[model samples]
Target: MELSELTIHKAHELLKQKKISSLELTMALLERIDACDEKIGAYISIAGEKAIDQAKIADEAIAKGNISPLTGIPVSIKDLICTKGIRTTCASKMLENFVPFYDAFVIKKLKKENAVILGKVNMDEFAMGSSTENSSIKITHNPWDLSRIPGGSSGGSAASVAADLCLASLGSDTGGSIRQPASHCGVVGIKPTYGRVSRFGLIAFASSLDQIGPLTKDVTDSAIMMNAVSGYDRNDSTSVSVDVPDYTSFCKKGLNGLRVGIPKEFHSYKGLDPEVDLAVKNAVKTLEDLGALSVEISLPHTEYTVAAYYVIAPAEASSNLARYDGVKYGFRDMDKKTLIEMYKGTRSQGFGDEVKRRIILGTYVLSAGYYDAYYRKASQVRALITEDFKKAFKKCDVILSPVAPTPAFTIGEKADDPLTMYLSDIFTLSANLAGIPGMSLPCGFSKSGLPIGLQIMGMHFNEEKIFKTAFNFEQATEFHNKKPMR
Candidate 1:
């Protein structure tokens, strides 16, 4: 296997045996990025020299016999996650040149483990769109087919893993950012329960719904990553103080006695693609064959998930994004005569169309006359959605479904229709709404050869259950071993 294609587990084994050096692995991936990233548009910036320096440090640690699963692994960070010295653009002109002095909590964890930081990857502007076409910098293409999108706003993160440009990556999930892209690119992406991973330096999109998680080449790699980054941080008030388990231990071979729930609402959606439905159903049957009991469950409020999410997420986005005005830092419009004009001009010129659209919709919803009618109602509906999941979990250990309604569409296919683009995340929005753990793994491929994903959701903070279920399914099928022919 190519050095760049090695999973975190494999790389660690080789590195510990002195069969390969961290510098060699890092160089291989750097070379791979040089060759493939231009065609994939998976990165916003590449820190070649910085990455090599980190790799050298990792090698020194490995020589000392002090290495973690990720000690020398090459990993990518979604642009939205702040890195102390590296440029963290969030794929928007608003902070296009911004650099932070402090790393995100997850970055701190990775740094402590000596993981080589490859570079920052592209995404939707401030993580506002379902397709990466909303990126102000570049549109990330699926490694499976260059003509199609790699999903978003973590499109770059998923594409990098799919293309073997990076062994694994960190991505923020708000709505379906991480899982949707992983589904499209045929990789494993997990969104931990809200507060499971600290969000100290994550560029806020929807404060209540946003989470940091892993996008990796396989389920085992995802587990290894979760061990390093999942924990509490004193800096983030929203971070939970719960104890994190060894996620890798959950990747066992059997699913005997496990109960899998099939939400009637999810499977019955009229917009679901026939191929995606079949792929997910087959995944469920594979689990059943492995001794899991399948049960029919109802999340009665499922239909309101999209509406509630659109309201709550955008409203929080508007509030969180208000700090990007020209005053403090980031891009400033020097030509503006007054402070107010500067704010208006900078935001109007800096943010992309989708970001502006969400901000406007958010502002309108949070406006005095509409707050009680829109935002307040959405919050109530959000509670109902949460209740639905809580009640469903009473019937099964995990819930299974399709990650998205369809395989990745052509780039620009839904660019003109905002509503259609929004609907793309219909199956994924509820998890964020309910603040639960969710994951997407490769299940099958479409007739056109695009990858399909099977989503497994567990109760809040019960990632181990989801991991066990996904791992069992992975071991039973060859889907996780399939790579895109770029």
Candidate 2:
């Protein structure tokens, strides 16, 4: 079988049964990259030597009768997550040469499980854009349609998985980063409840909103990866102490009697295309066909979420990115004579326009005089959004909606208008603000040949139920089997 065509579960089964060696799988994937990556540009770097070494060790471990489900399974890590001693640039020029000394909580987990790290995938600079075109280093085109985008921040990871460059990949979501890309690439990506996955060593875009999750070809693969990575980390100040459930056991549970809600307010948001609405409505019907009951619910404060995210995310980013001054970290423009001049010069030169724009905007909003007006108002709005979700969850196990307002747009479609691009996240951002798990999967496709995804929002720490629901729908529907026109 082609490396790209194999699901993570299938790969694991083959490895366990000795049908294929871990080394062989690693080599086949590497050869595929050699054949196709230049044109697709899905990866920023390919850790071939390390992946091969890791695969050999995995084979040796299995030979010794020591094994785990993830052992030898290959994964592409998103560029935003820190990998010890590796160039962990967050797809930004400021950290192009920055190498972290410690592994992120997720990276540590993957290593502990013996998963082979293929390399870091590209992303939007500081995760600010919806399209991968905002990547500081290079533009990543959709494998399904080269003229269009693969969605972003986690765009490279989504593209890699969808195009079969790797079995699965790690993607971080701040607002809609992971799930949006998953929607565009026609794969599965879940944004776990905030603090559910440790943020320690993940480059902060919006500290409170950022979350690490898995992007896989199927819900089962995502469940396996989630079980391997989700946990409490002492190193992460915000990490929750709640016990992470065994995702595999509950994933196969049928969705009979499950109560799913369709947010009436979110479904009516502007910019939603007619085709997307039809696809999502059809997906809801499929859930009903699978024995789940669906009802209309309301997230009353939906309007305030976008207003709050823009402010709160930037405020947190400004504070978190403060450490990037020339003297201690990030790029250093040593040409300046004075220390302060050096800081300004390096930041101005190193950061892309989007990063610079956010930093400045964030700094301004959080400034001594303006905090109450912009930052404080946004914080208050955040509370309202959370309260709204609390009320809605009382009525349903999860909320179902469109992952994005529209299907994958052409490459340059949303690039020029920052505000327009930001609106793309309108549907998925509320889950993050409320600290809930959200996921996107192929519900169906549009007539133009692009994919359509349904967004699923689950209650806090209820990831098992989320996957159970996803897995059930996945088994019942034929949508998951449709591949992009690659």
Best by TM-score: 1
How far residue 153's Cα lies from its native spot in candidate 2, in Å, is 0.9
Could you tell me every candidate's TM-score relative to the true structure?
Answer: 0.99, 0.98
Worst 10 residues of 2 by lDDT: 477-486
Once superposed on the true structure, which residue ranges of model 2 sit more than 4 Å away at CA?
A: none
Best by lDDT: 1
Report how far residue 38 has shifted in candidate 1, in Å.
Answer: 1.1
lDDT of 1 by residue, 1-486 (tens): 899989999999999999999999999999999998989999999999999999999999999999889998999999999999999999999998999999999999999999999999999999888778999899899999999999999999999999999999999999999999999999999999999999999999999999999999899999999999999899999899999999999999888899999999998999999999999999988999999999999999988888899999989999999998888879998899998999999999998889989999999999989999999999999999999999999999999999999999999899999988888788899999999999999999999999999999999889999999989889889988888885
Q: What lDDT, from 0 to 1, does candidate 2 have?
A: 0.88
- Model 1 off-target regions past 4 Å? none
Say what the RMSD of model 2 is.
Answer: 1.1
lDDT of 2 at 402: 95
